[model samples]
Target: MKNMEPRIFFKSSRNVAADTGLSKVSLRAGVGAFSLMEMMITVAIIGTLAALCMPAWTKIKDNSMRARDVSNLRGQAMAVLAYAGEHDGVLPGRINRGVAIPSTVTTDSKRTYYLSTVLIDAGYCSKDDKIWKTVCGYGADQFGVAYVVNSGKSSVPTYFFGNRSSTAGATTYDPKRIVSLKSNLDPDKDPKGKDEEPLSQIWMITNADGENYNSSTTGGLSNSLSEDVRTPWGGRHYVYFDAHVEFKRSGEYPSVN
Candidate 1:
């Protein structure tokens, strides 16, 4: 018989038995698995990254709230201007709701009504309007803080309304300054309207500081517990007579001419 070549058998990579020690062991040790130390290091790195991003995220959220406040103030200002246009160039200050303007200086004329109430009663805006609300607060309360005015006296609305004009020399609220309409000064209505200050110089509305109940802590508005009023951000929004809105830093206020 002719000499036969010895036959050798070789297994393909896929044909290797999984039960064999050589086949079961990974070529690169721990390539697909994480050690305890590796896992802890990964968690620490993720926490560090999140901590670094927190302040930036907080700033972004604050800016968004401020912008919303500015927009709401602008809308409220427009409503006030519209109300003035129909009422002989008179703004809503010391005006009673659902009642005629007092002709002579009397108790009724001196009585102050809430700006929101006056606006709502005149069909200018609704009570549920977001423009009447703000996102600023101290402690847990948010809505009640924005309207604080004149240090929050009893039975008085939280907004301050300076006298825009007087009718027949009637007593006016914050009677020191006379307000003008756009560029026109109604001499008959405002006897002190000689110097027509720029509309931008006069701030019609703004967030004020006062004491109010903390609804979150006090449980509701009925509680007598009060807290200082403040905005969520560090600045307050001002609405000028020209219906323009601007923001001022905390402790800074508008200078009215």
Candidate 2:
């Protein structure tokens, strides 16, 4: 009688075997599933890699910007030379010449190039002080010389070079004679004494006699280029007096001679 009850299990046993096979397959499919700690470790590694790369990326961006500034300055220098040639080998006077190259003259351009009134009438310079006292000045010291004297107020001075100041007839200005062509990150230096001696030493442009360079808060024609020289859109762009366009940098510049 007990054997008769057990005899009905044939098809049911087959169904049980099929279910077991499916369960095994499901378990195999999940074999590579990650644990919580493993996932966290992977995320941490990715974050570390990103942090390591950040500083290098920033340096690359800065170098690229510096290169662009150099290119822009060089182009502007060429334009000035072309203008001088067209005007009977005579360089421009302060106001007229500055207008000829609107890019250099304007405060809007965000980059600067030193200008000189040496080629203009010498009478424009102040006899008491060797500074050029017209709308433009010789070096950074004489820049805004007329503005300071005429206004009788010591406002901060601005020029094709950069910002400067004069105090009690003592010119307080940048010290780096030729801005380092390599970087514009130099520290600021105030003019030293009452004789305008500190201001006279700086150059307005690049020249064979080393008189072409100018002192600027952002460095002049020297290797030390400045970050301010970069255009908002990136890269340096300049227009010269001859209406020529130039791109320049540390490696390439015009010779004064």
Candidate 3:
């Protein structure tokens, strides 16, 4: 017995190997541990799972942002409605297009008014740097007036608040026409639901009528707009005179589909 070799027992061979501080087990009947291949497989599985989740995550994020953009439209609409209530069912009917004034509404009335200005004046929206500026739309960091209305009837000298179609309670609305929307395409180009845009894609060309849109951009209506200031999401947001907001697939002007 005194000549017998000393023996040690480990709760598990793995622990013994761990104590040895060796890279691999060398003992007979060594307890098994994960190999490099097993670790690699586990990593691949995890990577695949992440890949699968990415699209769904993107979709959810897009939906949330779209919802937020629509909410902004609704908020602006509410303010417009408030203005209408006070001014004999009229919008904040004072806008100054850099080009020419309309014969119907006199610019001589008072001061110039922009969409965001009016919203701020009425306290419906915050300051421009805060409200009109959004992380959503054509381009992520894109800023400036993110909205415009169906302020005009047929293209003419009219390009102001009163110029666009009546909000709620305005004598009428062209059912086939779109009201206010996110600035994706040329505001001058009236949406007629003409073409199928790429999914989640806002237009880059200004389809506005250079005649009425007279501007440095030219040939359309006025010169107030530029070559696609920024890119927007694929979806177009529509706010009708009814005041209820609707989110539909992104399409060109006129259609509002």
* Residues 175-224 of candidate 2: C-alpha lDDT, one tens digit per residue: 11121211111112322222222312222222111122123321342322
Residue 113, candidate 2: C-alpha displacement in angstroms: 15
lDDT of 1 by residue, 139-244 (tens): 3223233442221111121213443233478544541122433222223344442455677855666664332234442235332234565566655677777789
* Inter-residue clash pairs, candidate 1: none
At residue 107, give the lDDT of candidate 2. Answer: 56
Judge candidate 3 at residue 255 and give its lDDT.
36
- Using TM-score as the yardstick, the better of models 1 and 3 is 1
What is the Cα root-mean-square deviation between model 2 and the actual structure?
A: 15.8
- In model 3, the runs with Cα more than 4 Å from the true position are 1-34, 96-111, 128-131, 140-143, 153-160, 163-232, 248-252, 255-257
Off by over 4 Å in 1: 1-32, 95-112, 139-145, 148-194, 211-228, 255-257
lDDT to native, each model: 0.52, 0.32, 0.45
Q: How much RMSD separates candidate 1 from the native structure?
A: 10.2
Better of 1 and 2 by TM-score: 1
Residue 200 in candidate 1 has what lDDT?
Answer: 80
TM-score of 2: 0.33
